[model samples]
Structure formats: structure tokens, C-alpha cells
Target chain A: MGLLSLLSGLCRWNNNDEENSAARSFILSSVLWLAFVVSLALILATKFVWPDFLGGTAWLSFGRLRPLHVNGALFGWLSMSSTGIMLYILPRLTGVRLYSERLGNLTCLLWNLLLIGASITLPLGYTQGREYAEFILPLDYLFMSILALLGYNVFKTVARMKDKAMYVSLWYFLGSLVWMPFTYMVGNNFLMDTTGLGGRGPVPGVNDAMLNWWYGHNIIGMWFSTLGLGIFYYFLPVLTKNPLYSHRLSLIGFWTLAFFYVWNGQHHLIYGPGPDWLEDVAITFSVLMLIPVFAVVYNFFKTAQGSWHLMFDNSPEHLPVRFFMIGGLAYFLTCTQGPFQALKAVNSNLHLSYWVVAHAHLAFLATFSFISMASIYYVLPRLLNTSINLRLAHWHFWLLCLGLIIFLGILHTAGIVQGAMWLVKLEEYDFVTGSALFKPAVEFIDIVRLLHPFYFTLWLGAGLMATGVMLFVVNVLLTFYKADSPGGRLRSKGA
Target chain B: MYTALILFILAGSIICLGGIYYKRSIVLGILVPGAMLLIIIAFLSTAVLPYMEKIPATDKGVPYSERALLGRQIYVREGCWYCHTQQVRPIRTDAGLGNVSQPGDYQYDYPHVLGTERTGPDLSHLGGKYEDDWHRNHLMNPRPKTPEEEGMAGKVKGSVMPPFSYLSREETEALVTYLQSLR
Candidate 1:
């Protein structure tokens, strides 16, 4: 009788009113960080246009602040919020409460601490000095530990799932966790001999470069892309009230993505110093990446076939759907740009130029960030059982879209001009004359001067984006105040 | 290295099989194993094989001196590599930067600083391009401090490279040493 009772208790459905405090806390914290980091980014943009805006402060200097800004946006904002979304979605899809809300909340606490540690240490000139892998050794260990715990929590929850059929979203979430720890370990040069091998740190020389980009691009491909895509899959079905386009298509996309994205790192080294075959592998796989990207995008569009018109509805309740559609379009564009730029002909001119920076933002800010915003807006109200202000949500959407369009437009133009101007200085030889050839062109300095106007406008667009984020934070906080009343539940339900 | 790869595949397969047996889910078994194989193969082809390749240093490739090493640390700490790329390609745009780089050229760069952007300029062959005094002043203020300083590569009017005047003299010297040692 005791054993039977225990089994029955385990299988019991959680009350609909059960407080999901872990997801709620994580979403709130992520919003605050988003506001903070966007403000930091706006400052960075200002410094680009006016270099002397905040000159002479060591901590506030561009180099130090640059790393902090990147880490903040990536780990602080995106990773934390994605984890929150995953935790929330896991229980709903699996038909059980999270295995341990206590552990989930603990993960959130530790993640915030890790970000705080990075914020303090990176600005204080303590870092490992690699891009995207700059956190000190101790922080790396802390992050990995937290990740392991989170993975265990997720797997435990999935093990007890009431539903027998595994969802596509679950595949992405689980696969992402499996890939991340190894990717982080190898990329950060952890768990290896640090002082051996020519004393150039773990994984020496050009191999370190290969390892770095492998880690770097995969952090995007494996972690962020997977998580964001999973969230996209979850929200698409929920918002549109449609079944997934095809289960087979989703699996094909996942497998192809896992295979091809890993081979793409060396494309960053094209025309540089890696072996020829390595570069060829990178290029070929990078192009092949289109298969998975197209598959996922097609699945998304097909699922939203009848619901496409719903995106035009700007009501507060409908904002999440709009965000998802626009974000989906941005994902398609970002992936198309990825394969296009990976080509050697385009890469030779555009590599190490502002074009790449534009591409990074298109992926991070426009695609994943937008998808994240949609997830947060959709999930937060449902978790809180309170509705947010419609006007504020509208403002947030339009302002951010306008700002991103302006910001990306200026950057793309600047990159092309920069590339063409650099090419004008290229040394040419005429075989007929058997002598050096030269052509008149504007100086590199002249090009820098010409870009000043564009940089100023870029800063302005960033300011607008920052304002939109601040409004979002305000609306979310206001929702919390309204959460306590019985009327709040009714309002949300009515919406 | 080979043992490590074999061990990883073995361990991963066991784990997947265990999960499959416990959950009775063949999909998890297949999917997890497939992902494991693909990532390992990718890692082997890109990182492990490259690390094991035998490439002797070119004539221009040499190890760093102790001071230059210290400078490399300072260069990294200040994140100068964020703006400046260290590799010169054979493309037309990089025609006059220097000799096109080789795999052996980076034999001593443990944590390679082949940066991904040219917000400033490529620094692959920046060594001896200008006087030490020019470097000092340029580091102090990337923009020209005087008319004579105008029209230089990084000292142009609108250059956005941040001033490193906050760095101690020793740190600055070490960083400059590292920069000058690049060639």
C-alpha cells in the first residue's frame, strides 16, 4: 500500500495554480540584464563615434568594456533567459512539474553570481584574453559546474515525462546540453595541459586558432542556435494552434546541423594560414549548412501557413506571434548570409571587415534576441497569470525594429565602402610591362573620416534600441505589481 | 591523442546505450550516438589532426623573448587583438601588408591572435613600419595630437582605437616590444 501510494503521488498532476517561481525569477532577472547590457552597448556605440566621450578611465575604456558588453549580452542576457524558457517549457511539454524547482532556482542564483564575477574581474584586467573565452579559469569551472547541474535537472525531468513521444524541442534542448560542455572545455583550453607544448598555453599555435573558432562558432551553432530554434518550435505550435509541419523534417534539420556546423570554424581562417584542406572542408560544410537552415525555416513557414496574417495584429496578446514571425524571417536571412559570406570570393573582401560585425548582429540581435524576446513576452504573462500594458509592448516592438533596420543598414554600407577603399590600395603588376602598376585612390584615413557620419547615426539607432529595452523592463516590472490581485488572472485570461 | 578520441567514443556509446536501455527509447539511442560521432569526427578533422601535423617553423618564425612574451600578455589583457588582425593573407587587398602568412609562421602563437575584425588595421607586419616614438604617441592617442601626426595609418583624424595611456610605462613598453617583434 505504501509503495502504491508513492507511485500515485509521483504521477499526480500539478495544480494549475502551482507557482513556477524559478522560471518567473529567471525571466525577470534576464530582463533586467538585457536593459543593463543594452545601455552598456549604447555607451560603446557612442564611444565609437566620439572616441573621447569617456576617455582616460581604465575600467570604462573600450577594450575592457568590449569584453564585458559581449559577455553580458551573451551569457548574462541570452543564456540565462534561454535556460528560463527551457525550464518553463520542459514541464509543460513533459506533463510534469520541474524535477526540482529548488535546483532550478539555485542554478539561476549561481548564474547571476557568475555574471557578477565576470563583470568585476574582466574590467579589473583579470581574464584569459581569448575572445568569447575571456573569463578566468575559476569562472570557467563555476560555469561548467552550473551547466552540468542544469543538464542533470533537465534529463531528470525528461526521464519522468508523462508523455511517451519525444518532442523535437526536447531533442534540441538535450543535444545542446550534450554539445556545450565539451565545446566550452575545448574552446577554453580547460582540462588539458596548460604549460606543456611549446609553453603557448593548452592546444598551441595555429591549432589553438582552429580550436578557438571551433568553440566560437559552435557556441553560436550548437548552444544559442539550438536553444533558440527549440524555443521557436515550442512557441510556433502553441501560438498558431497547428501541428508541426513535419517531424521527419525537424529531425533531418537537427542531424544535418549537428554534422555541418562543426566543420565551419576554419572558414574564418580562409586566405590566412590554416592548411588548404582544412579551409576547403570549412567552405564545403558551410555551404552545406544551407540544407539544415532551409529545412528548419521551411518547417516554420509551413506551420504558420494559415497564421501568417495573425502577425499583423498588434494587440498585447498577439505581440508574441508577431515577434516569432519576424524573428523567423531574420533567421532565414542570417543563415543565407552565413553561407554566402563563407564563400572564399566574398570572404576575401569582407573578412575582418565591418561586414562580419553586421552579420554577427543580424544573427545575435535580430534573430536569436528577437526570438528570445518573443519567448519572454509569451512565457512571462502565462507564468505570472497577469497581463502587460498593450501600448508599451507595441512601442517596444516598433522601436526595436526601426532601430535594428537603421543600425544594420548603416553597418552594411560602411562595410562595403571600407572593403572597396582597402582594395583600391592593392598593388598591381602589368605582365606586359613587367613592372609594378599603381592607381590613384583615396587614402585609408580619408575613408575613416568619411565613416564618421555613419557611426554617429549608428549610435543614435543604438540609443533607440536601448530605450525600447527600458520600456520592456518597465512593462515587465509593472506586470509583477499587478500579479497579486485576483483581477489580474481574469485580465490575462480575457486577453 | 588517438587514445583520447577512442575513449571518448567508447564512453559516449556506453552512456547512450544505457539511456536507451533504461528509457526503452530507440530514438534517443540513435540520435545521441549520431551527434556524438559527428562532433568527434569534426573535432578530429579540424583541431586534433591539425594539432598533430608536423610543420617546421619558417625562417621568419621565431619564439618570443621573455619581455616580448610579457608584452603579448599585456596586448591580450588590453584586448588590442579585438581590433587588429595578426595574419596577412595573399589576397589583393593584403598585397602590401607583408609576406603571405604560412602555417609555420604561427608555430609559437599558443593562443593565436588572428583577430576577426579590422576596426583598426592589420598588424601582421606592423613591426618597424614607424619609429618607436611614433608607436608610443600613437598608443597614447590613436588620433593625431598634432598636424604632423596627421595622415598616418592609425593616427588619422577619425581613428577609433582607444588611448592606452592608462597602461603603466612598463606595460606599454612590453606591449610595444611584442608589437615590434611581430615581424
Candidate 2:
């Protein structure tokens, strides 16, 4: 009976008219995660240990490693995880067999390949010279193609849905499917950079800034946040066995965030070389962004109201949901602090400090960790057709949360140290090039910074984070084998 | 101090007002004070403003520092702010770039382009740190710029600053004009 139940959970969702084929989605997901782990090991090794590599090339310096790490986590890990969830999620949400299994398989294969290109070309010194748009232009074209295919499949699935509600996940899924391409095109200058879609001249910095930010911030909002939000909407209620506190609030949070999130990316540029008004606008939205963030977090937390135990020791199936919970909170904290940091006065000091890096990682990795972990918990057991070992799942949860605190805490405190020291220094004629003021800060925070400031501490934090990720990767692999429960079987026909 | 009080209260109130607040965000309500704390910090920011150093009005022409400020404008327009910081910190703090950035140096800075992220190095005190030739080489091809390769000091340090071959000589000169103007 348990075996049959497991099978139904695994294959039934994909094939009634069709077989349990989107199986490639499972392979894609596993391979993507495996690839991410392996690549991360190399990247981290280079940054932490192999102080000298690439035969003394300029591009391989640690200055560039920052972007590489971000790309790996965001594009490599987070993007694939979201796609994997969509394999099951889109079908289940839409209540229909995938429109084309072959197409789905192709898209998954091409998407990972394109990501591979981004990793290779970017590190090999081929890049577009923009922050997020670093992958050379052709790689971007490959990305856009994957998005287009995914869009087609999803639209076809939506057309077939029996459920009229278009559950919020579909709304968000479709939103991502639409918005990212638009964001990419403008940011990548897709037409102009290629076939000359628009006339070019002194590409207005403000215009480019706005466009880059619009795309950058939206990825956080429409892609990762929306997906993360959808996961919360589905899993929180299921785990707690409670009706979502208010679908009304959920809708409000969703749309408000959609508008606000895109604008907030500008906050990253405040006190920058941008104009005064631009900084003002960035600061304003940085503050205004609080609305949607609060809405999502409050609503999610509120849903767990009375069923506090559900949040406690529970089925292994729910650990990822707990991650989403904490991730939602971290998002709120990060966003709240984000606007404050954007303010001119504070920004004057905090702009180039580790504090910003801490926040950036907290915001990105927090949401990434939450959503990715939740996706794994929600789907992996089902994918493997077995219940996860609850104890192992709990270990994964603690390690991740603790590691985040260690990582983020160190960065945040280090950032403050960096910011304060900067402010205390001379800026004009008397200014000498030295880290004197900053030295005391590093010393004061030595317990926190632990050792010398700069690369070592950063590598340490990233190291702990890598360890946590390794733990998670192991747990997911172990789930491939069956648990000794009724939930272990994979066929409803009862072999 | 008020900022501390407000933050404490703000954090405390969030804990106090636990549980669902509907479409009405209790968190944003708390965030209002966070904004207030920012205003307070900005008020205290006057300390840095006074330290901004003025150009000595060069006999060669319109104080090249002003031109450097112009170059900084280009830096901003180009989204260099997205990756690099201009502000330097005080003391031996590990981050304010390797120097204690001075207030006098930024007096003329209208928008104060000190950035927050180290997607690149803090440029608070990049003045006289490089020569025209070195800056040219780095800007033309960051891929080849040596980044001082190793060690703490080099007469002509290597760097990973991107190539600005896209800019004309005048534009590049203007940029160099502005960069050299940095204290």
C-alpha cells in the first residue's frame, strides 16, 4: 500500500494519457545539482587554496571570483532547481500532462548546456563587461532560447488546465516565463547588440542602469521570489494542515512585490556615480519595497499560527518548508536593512564594505537556500518514491541554518567594520592610502572576523557554507534508496 | 543613540505584535522607524561633508580635480558603481581600500560616488597610485593588467581594471584627468 502510494505520488502526476515521462526533468535536476556541487568545489578550491592559477592570467584573479561564485549559485544552482520544480509543479498546478515530454527534455538539456557555457566563457575571459550580464552575448542567446521553449510548453499546459483558479503558482510561473525574457532582452541589448534592433550612440548610463536593475531586481522578484512564494503558498498549508491564513493577503503580497522588487535593485547603486535624483528614487523604493516583503513573510509565518509543532520536529518531508520559513524572514531583514543602507549618509560609509556583501549573499543565498531546500524536500522523496530519513533531514536543516548564520554574520559584522573604518578615514588632500582606521575595526571584530580581514575570512565563510551544501547533497543522494516503510514502493499496480 | 532606541523598539515591537496582520503589514510599520534611523544617520553625515578637500585651483587650468570629478561622472554613468567603490575608510580597517580616506578629498564631490560593494576595489584614494601609462594599460585590457601580481608594493602595480579601449584619447584623458584628481 505504501509502495503504491509512493508510485502514485511519483508517476501519476506526469502521465494519465502519457507515461511518467518528464523523467528527464528528474535526471536534469540531479545532474544540475551534482554539477553545481562539483563546480563549486573547484571554484572554492581556487579561491581558498590555489592562490595562484590560470597560469597567471588577469581574469582568474579573486576580484573576478566574486562574480563567478554569484553566477554559479544563482544561474547554476538556483535556476536549475527552479526548472526542476517546474517539471512536476507546472503539471500538477495545471492539472494536465506535459504538452510535450520531448520538448521538456530538450529544454532541460539545452538550459544546462547554456549554463555550462556561461561558466566556461565567463572564466575563460570571455564576458560582456556588465555585472549580471557577464556571460558573453551568444551564451545569452542560448539562455533566451531555453526560456522561449519553456514558455511555449507552459502556455500549452495552461491552455489544457482543468482547474479554473490558475493557482498562484501558475500566475507566478507564467510571470517568470514572460518577464525574464523581456528583462534579458533589454539588459543584454539583445536586438541592438546583434541585429541592430535600436539605434545606438552614447548608451545613456541612467538608461542602462535602469534596464540592468530592472532585469536584475526582477530575477529576484518574478523568478526566485515568485517561485519561492508559490512554494510557501503550497507547502506551508500542507505541512501545517491549515488553510492559508488569507489568500487575499497572498494576492496583495504577490502583486505588490512584483512592482516593488524590480525597482529595488537600484538601491545597489545608490551613492554611486548616478545622479542625485536616481539615488533618491533608489532610496525611495528601497523603503517602499518593505510592503511586499512584509506581506509575504507575515502571511507565511501567520499560517503556522497555532500549529507550532508542525514547525518543530516533524516528518522529514517538512524540513525544507522550515527553510522557506526562515528564508522568508531573512528576506524581510535583508530588505529592511537594504533601504537603510541605500540612504546617502549610511551609504557613504557602507557602500563598498563587507556589510553589503553580507546582505547581498543573505538576500540571494537565503532565498536560494530556502527555495532550493524546500524544492528538494517537497519533490525528492516523491521523486525517489520513498520517505526521507527524517533524522538526516533534520541534520541538513540545522547545518544549513547554522552555516548561514556563520557566513552571513561574519560578512555583516565585517561589513560594518569596513564601513565604520572608511568613514573615520581622510578623504581629501590629507587622505593617505592605508587601512589604519579599518585595522582597528578588523582587530576589534577579530573574534568575529576571526583572523586577518579580507580573503581568508571570506573563504572561511564560503567554506562553511560549502560544507553545509555538501551535507545536503549527500542527503538528497541517500534519498535515492528506499526507506523501510510502506512509503517505499513505487507502483500503484502493486507488483 | 536615538537610532539605537528606535531600532530596539522597532525590533521589540515586531516580536510583540506577532501573528498575522492581514494585508496590513506590521513589518512595514516597524520599518518606518528604520527609515527614521537612516534620516538620523544622514544628519550625522555632516562630519564627512566637512572633510571634503578642495582643489588648489591648478595654475595649469581649471583644477584637474574638477576634471577628475568629471571622469567619476563617467564612471557612474558607465555603472562602475555597480561593481566598484570610491569611498575609503579611516584607520587600518581592512576594507576602506588600504587607506584611511580623507574628508578633504571628497569636498567637491557632488554625489559622493563611494560605492558599497567590492565587485571591484574601493577607489577612495586612487590618486597618484598609478601612472598615466599604467592606468592606460589596465583600462585597455584588464585581462592583461598584472594586479601587482603579488607582494604589497610595486612601483607600477598590475591591476584587473577593465580595458577602456572603447573610449577616445580625449575621453580617456578626461577620465585620467578625473582619476588623478582623486586625493
Candidate 3:
């Protein structure tokens, strides 16, 4: 019938040029959507300092908006952006055209629509109450479908690859493709309360917590970190114009990451009521994780051995490599800090503090977002066949770097102060009554008040970062516009 | 510690060495399915299996009533868990948090609201910590201008918590009911 033919036509793989263009369009759309959400989230953060700034409105309240921001940035921005990069990269790495450009476009469309649904519903307070897995059941189904479609497209492309040797990046992409959907189902679906549908109900609270964190930590380690690493592995060598230092080291990094990262979730519950063995195992694996971390770090640094000067070259051309190098440093710091914080002595003080917040931002924003930005820069010129505005790129880089430094530094300092204040004890000498006694002093509320300056600093930092993001968006848009116009010549020089 | 270390080594070897040794298809087939099975088994043994055996009856952690459940939903909706942690760790710093949280403490909790941050404070043992009147006043106005206005001056001076005056009376009462039942 007409519908069937139309469906088959949509599933047909277009020519390479059209397929690549489709991939570029998807990535650009994701970037635009994420940029807007991230900015809105940052602006919403200002209300924390001035609590009643937008208090009366139902949708504008902190509670509703915060989750939207978190989920929006995580799912809408990071996940979507990563997917687009994978779509673009996988074909090139495999030396094959995408299996189905229409499927790719459909997936992107559905994914963005799901994000739109989430944006509307989340602010309207329709949530599952789970961190990272906050989207409602319908959205979860949509997400699973998107992943399935993407997985099929990717795996099929790999199957048809003209290249024989599977690159380190392909290994990571394959592993992540398999792991993400399974992880999502386990975390968001099985253990949820379906009592309204006549189910036996959810697992106990402690078990749910364990499962949630299991899903939570892996979402970062397996999905974001894995894909980001793949992108890093792929783009680093290409940008540096050197082969990977050691393919063996890269493989070691990938395999070790897969085995060790799964056991890391329980560390988030270190001092919580989980069995002692669980916490112990998590800590041990966390420490062992340093192997893969170091492996990748060594590989990257060694790969860029002679090209270290490029990191200092601040020209518009060197921007992506510079971002990648800085992101590499942040990744190292995040991984190192991960195991250190997993230690009981450190977790005790830092668990609930802004220290964790700083760590999350370091991993997500500084590491993954930076890599994604680099990948975008690398891809944009090649995709459009034009150079980006160099001055704007420089502006974007400095503003973001400055903003992140201030934000992270202030939060870490505030965390230490808050932890110390919470643990502070006062010695009391009842001289008038001739009794010597010691008691805990310092009201919790007072500690909260003391953090006002740090909170203000956080707001300021977020503002700067938001501005940087806006500039990047504008720059990309202008470049795209210029490329389409007459007399706007594509650079005939080096990539 | 030794067992954990050994397991870590074994896991690393299986995946890394397996990938290096075997063909790509075989490695991919084993890695993904094997990992999925391992995670499920791990969860079953560590968390789910224990709950099946050790969960207690109503005397310890009863199920939420309709109103309290409603309030709990509201709490989740508001993202209160983002700020106020519900699990009190067994540490000196948490000595004032009123009792180390036991596994049984959250038996009735569905999607466990044991939050990760303490932007506010621990709410695990907040039951009966303050009178309902005080809670109502504080939720409406966490920091009031006059001491006489809401009796919050002496109790919570310089508290940075946002006022929840926008919540309807019914929503406030439901939330308070949920908080009071945490014990």
C-alpha cells in the first residue's frame, strides 16, 4: 500500500552526502535545544539566591524547574549531543555510509519530540521522582525506542563496514550502545511501583536505592563517559594528525572501564545503610578504576607528545584540540577525585556537601561537555566546508573556563566550610556552677546562613557559563548563515 | 578487602583479556550479555535478596496512608530530596541527626527518597522535631521579619530555606503529615 511504500522509502539509506548532512542537522538541532535548556536552568539557579524571585508560580518554582533542568541537560543535551556525534562518527570510522539516513532522521525527530514532552511535563510536575530517571513512564518507553533504533542503525553500519579492524572508538561505541538500554530498563523500569496496574509493587526502599545508584552511576560511567571516551579517542588522533600512541593501551582502557565501572554505583552509598560488603566492594573497584583512567590519560598525553605546542596555540584553528586537552585534564581530575571521595573518611564529610556537586559538574560539564564542544567544532567546519569565526571561538572558550573555575572553586571551599561547621564541637566551662562540661555548638541554621556568599558566587559563575554557551550558539548560527550566502568562500587550506 | 581486590582483578582480566584474545563478534556477544547478567545477579544478592528475607511487618515502617502518600508525591514533585537527605549516616558528624538509619527504616519507601545532598538538612528523624504550628509557620515563611510574626526568630535564625507559602493549605498539611510520619 501507499503507507508501506512510504515507510520503506523512509528506511532506505540515502547517498553518503545526504546521510552526512542528515547527521549534521540532527547534531546542530540537539546543540541548539541543549543550549537553550542549559541557559534557562542557569537562570533558574539565580532564584536559589533570591528564593522568592519567582516563588508564586507553580511551574516556575524551584522544585519543578530543577528536575526539568537536570533531566533536560542530561537527557536532552548531553545524551542527544552524544548520539548525534556517534551518528556522524560511526559512519566515518567504519568507512561506510549510514545504514539508514531516514531511520537516523526519524530517531532524531522522536528524540527531540520526547525532549519537548519532558520540557512541558517536568515543569508541570509530572515526574517519577527518581534522579536521572525522572521522566515519566511514557517518556521512558520513547527513550528505549530511540535507543533501540539508534543501536540498530549503529550495529548495522558496523556490520557493513568497509574497514576490517575495529577501532578502539568502535569498541567503546558498541559497548555503550549495548549497555545503555539495558541499564536504562533495569534502573527505570523493573523496580518501579506499578501498583496502579495491579503489580506486587516496588522493591524495598534500601533495594531501590541500591538499584537506583547502580543505574545512576553506570549512566555516567558506561553511557556518557564511555561515549565521550570514544569521541576523544577518535577525534584526538585526527585533530593531532598522529596515530594513537598505543592501540593496545586504548584497548586496555576500554576493557578495564567496562569491567570496573559497573561496581562503582554502591560507592555513592558508602556511609549509608547498605551492607558493609557492598560499600567495601564499591570502594575497592573505585580504586582499581584508576588503571583505565591512567591508561587513557597516558595514551592521550603520549599521542600528543610532539604536538604539545598546539595546546598553547590559541588560534581559532587550534580551538578543538585545546578544548580536548583541557577536557582530558578535567577527566583525569574527575576520575582521581572519584576514588578519593569513595574513601569512608572523605565520604563522611563530603557526601552531602557541595563537593559532590562540584565533582558532578567537573565530570559532566568540564569533561564531557568540553569534549562534545570539541567534537562539534571539528565536525562543523568539515560538515559545512567552512571555518568558524575564530574570535568568537576564543571568547567562548575563555568565558566558559573562567566561569567553571570560579563555580567549582567556590563550591569546594563552601563544602569544606560547611562540613567543618557541621562537625565543630564546643567545650563548655561552667565556671559559675563549678562544673566542666563539653557540648556541641553551632546551629545548623547558622551554617546555612554562612554559605550565602558561596551561593552568590555560584550564581555569578553559572551566569558567565550561560553567556559563554549563548555566544557559542550565535557563532555557530552565523557561520552556518555565512556558508550559505554568496561570496562566503570555504577555506581551501588545512582541516 | 582481599576478596574485593581479587574479584576486581578477575573481572578486569575477563573483559580486557577476553577482548584482546577473542574475535570481535564473540567479545561483543559475551561482554554485553555477561555484564547485564552480572549486574542483575549482584543486585539480587546484595539488595533484593536481603529485602525478601528481612522485611518486617507494620510495627516497623508501615505503609503510607492516602494523604501521606499524596504528600510524599508532592515532596517528590517539589524535588525536596535534592536538598534534604533522608538517610542519616553512622558518623560523628551525623550524631545530631537522631539515630543511624537502618535498612528497615525505609521498608515502605517506593522509589527511596534518600537524597544525595544536604543543602538543607536531614529529614529522616524530623518527626515531632517541631510542633505542627511551627512547621506551618516555617513553611509559609522560613525567615520572617518579626520574632512575633511566626515565632521563627528564636528557632531558626538566618535559615536560607525558601518559603513554601504558595502551596495550598491542603498541600501543606499533607506534606507536614508525611514529614511527621517519617519516624
Can you list each candidate's DockQ?
A: 0.42, 0.07, 0.48
Give the clashing pairs for model 1: none
TM-score per candidate, chains pooled:
0.90, 0.69, 0.90
Candidate 3 residue pairs that clash: none
Where does candidate 2 chain A have its weakest 10-residue lDDT segment?
A194-203
- The A-chain TM-scores of all the candidates are 0.91, 0.82, 0.91
Deviation in angstroms for B21 in model 1? 19
lDDT of 3 at A470: 80
lDDT of 3 by residue, A1-87 (tens): 433432232233222236565566566666767676776768576876887677767788787888877777788778877888888
- List, residue by residue over A1-495, the lDDT tens digit for candidate 1: 433432232222112233465676577678768877888898899999889777677888888888999989999899888888998999888898888877777777788789889999998878666789888888898899989989998888888876567888988998898888888998888655343233265544778788889899999999999999999889988887789998778877877788779878999889878877778878988998998899899998899989987889877778888888888999999999999999999998888888888999999899988898888889878877767788898899889888999999999888888888878863478889898754325665677788889899999889888888788887876776566334765235532
* Highest DockQ against the true fold, candidate: 3
Model 1: DockQ vs. true structure: 0.42
Worst 10 residues of 1 chain A by lDDT: A6-15
lDDT of 2 by residue, A1-495 (tens): 543543343343343323334543443354345446445545644443333344234445443444566676677677767666766777776678878876776676676677767667655545444566666678788888888988898778777766556555565566666566766765565434522111112233333444455456656766776665666566667766777787767655655554445545556655443334445645776776677677777876788777666556576655665776676677777767866787767776666566866776777778656766766777776755666667766776776677677778777776776556444433343356642232222322222233244445556656666666666765665564354234555334342
| Cα displacement (Å) at residue A94, model 1 | 0.7
Q: How do the candidates rank by lDDT, highest first?
A: 1, 3, 2
Candidate ranking under DockQ, highest first, comes to 3, 1, 2
Residue A63 CA displacement from its true place in model 3, Å: 1.2
Proportion of native contacts kept per candidate: 0.56, 0.08, 0.50
